[model samples]
Target: MIEDQLTEDDVLLPTYGPRPVTFTSGAGSWLTATDGGRYLDFLCGLAVTGLGHAHPVVTQAVADQAARLTHTSNLFGTRPVLELADRLRRTLGWDDGRAFFCNSGAEANEAALKLARRHGKHADPQKVHVVALDKGFHGRLMGALKLTGNPAKHAPFEPLGTWATHVPADDPDAIAAAVDDRTCAVWLEVVQGEGGVRPLSEEVLAAARAACDDHDALLVVDEVQTGVGRLGEWYGWQTTTVEPDVVCLAKGLANGLPIGAIVARGVAAKAFQLGDHATTFGGGPVVCAAANAVLDTIESDGLLAHTRAMGSRLAAGLEALAADSPLVTGQRGRGLLRAMTLSGDFAPAVADAALRHHLVVNAVAPDAVRLAPPLNVTPDEVDEALSRLRAAVADVASPTGASPTGASPTGAAPAETDGR
Candidate 1:
């Protein structure tokens, strides 16, 4: 049971409607709550913990870096940060690219937007417009939020600059129609995570690239959720033929540590000269050290291949579960970032039922339940999750409208789209 002390004192932020359970620690693909119960974690901190919880390599990197050097600010150089940047550039095969680091996915996107604007200014001062996809999420800061397409999130902050134009994903014509000479940049996710785990078609991504090229606009790919082997690639766009001028990554960069990066290629990289942009906490020693370890382990352990195999296994399991259920409509996504759609908006109920079975899952949208398990999740773990999910679906699909225990069904709507 949850302690009532916090409610009485009101010490925590009201932003989150947190569950009663408090996690004490985690290892591999499991988390232990304060009450001593272990649960399989499929959410993976919204796709941040790619290597899994308490990964030995990451833990050791953090400890060793903390003992060596933690922070020295952007005013000075750090070896780990430079090494990590070089490794990223080499791994992505973008030799002409430059990197700008930050503390979270949002900041990384903000920097990318800033770079786009600055790049445009160099060509034409009037080119300040940005184009993004509907149902696509970037980040939360003012600039990043402006690129986000969900109206519910932007409505409250109306009167936001009209610098951004929104278009539907996978609509090449719509994307082309939105871009013109005045547009500075076009932003999109290879797979829309918060927006129901929808993957953009190859033709659509190719069209966006052509449109950007035609109008001389920079293409920005938001890889916050899909980068670092989540999509079975170092960067999500690698799976596609399209090459973005700028890419933003974060979520799994440090395997749960806070780190974000904006990688720019060719002229886009030269757009930001000295004094154009900087972040004090960007690429701090400790986080960079952790990121280095993440990259090393990912390569050394062949987690990329593991992620691909496990993702297919997990997706097959989800399909099997949906095959016999009326509630599940379909499954979508690539690699580990997958979602199961329901016939109706029963995502929240399904999540609750999964919790009851000691599994952690999240409903990305009203009718979509997203699963971004750790890239290293084992086949046995995937099998267990499928079993729990099968039971959850059955429990939610029961006609009695009550759990087996005769309790009222919890009716909370699925959590909002991560404020995409």
Candidate 2:
């Protein structure tokens, strides 16, 4: 039912392979397509819409801020930016820290990498090497891409940058083997989002911290996808015992608005001087207003606890489904960011099937389907998604082939308890 006039004429970017459906509007956990079909959005714009689409608080903030002021170059101070930064520092419990703003996760990480290098230069120019986890995704820019460990995404952009090494995630020994006196920084994600929603173990994180300290290297946590209640906390690193010297955040920071930040603490906070880094649209009043509103709403509405409860419910349902299905090899992740790995590479088919069922999910890996639904997703919506996902998994497994475990092609059937 899409209008004939609806075409991709204005889109200039070739980054995404979009689905046929064009979402015209959204509310809470559901999106209304251009064709007027309602679909539950489990992708949540890749975990950017922490409070959901068109959230009243965010909309009001943007509107009001636009009316007052939108942009003021970094030459002038803005109230919204000051307030937002103060709130971030308070929420994250970072003392004697400084924040640099940007327009995307990639930019935030880029700034962090620059700061790390600056810190190293101050210590010793020889300490310039950066160590990151294998399969860890930082971003797509030159510097950020250099920090990313995915070879497939980096090969074409090879000879891009120097002083980067990769170690297997969740392996303390591997990470320890990589960090050395010359290492400038050790960057990692609390939970590897693009690498299949894999969570780094607490031991690994602690060991990385110890290694960085021993080597006088900065520990940078990329919380772009795992921050702002997505992982049941303000930041994913908060869930772990280890603390990072620097943190990069974006995605849910300003709801859907473009905003990224690199926060540095302790001695790392002094890595950059006044003229070292700057951005035109980094802390524009409008975006900062939106971010302040998001933080306020998350607190006032108790979305953090809600995210934890809802995430548990959703994870439990997926786990129960996988318990009987040979198709689902396993499940991992925390809070609303979770993934289910299939026995085979049916992620694309399963995602398509979910779309057919008026649901939206993402295939993060060849055999893994990622779910990052809104933190405010309701119990009834979760129940409906569980049922639809069961059907989709059955449809994919039955027609293709039984799993290697010799279980029925349909795997496990949906529970009859009617939890809703």
The most accurate candidate by lDDT is 1
How do the residues 1-420 of candidate 1 rate in per-residue lDDT, one tens digit apiece?
566455623777665665546789999999999789999999988899988899999999999999989889998988999999998898789998789999999899999998999988888999989999998888778888888888878877877898999998979999989899999899999999888899999988988999999999999999999999998988899989999999999999999889999899988988888898888889999999999999999999998888889989988888887889988877888889999888777776677788789899887886888899998899999999999988888888885543432222244433333333
Instruction: Give the residue spans of candidate 1 off by over 4 A.
Output: 1-4, 7-9, 400-420
Which runs of model 2 end up more than 4 angstroms from their true locations?
1-6, 9-13, 400-420
Task: Give one clash count per candidate, in the order shown.
Answer: 0, 0
Q: Which lDDT tens digits does candidate 2 get at residues 7-93?
A: 565454644544458889999989999789999989888889988899998999999999999888999999999998888888889
CA lDDT of 15 in candidate 2?
A: 48
Residue pairs of candidate 1 with colliding backbone atoms: none
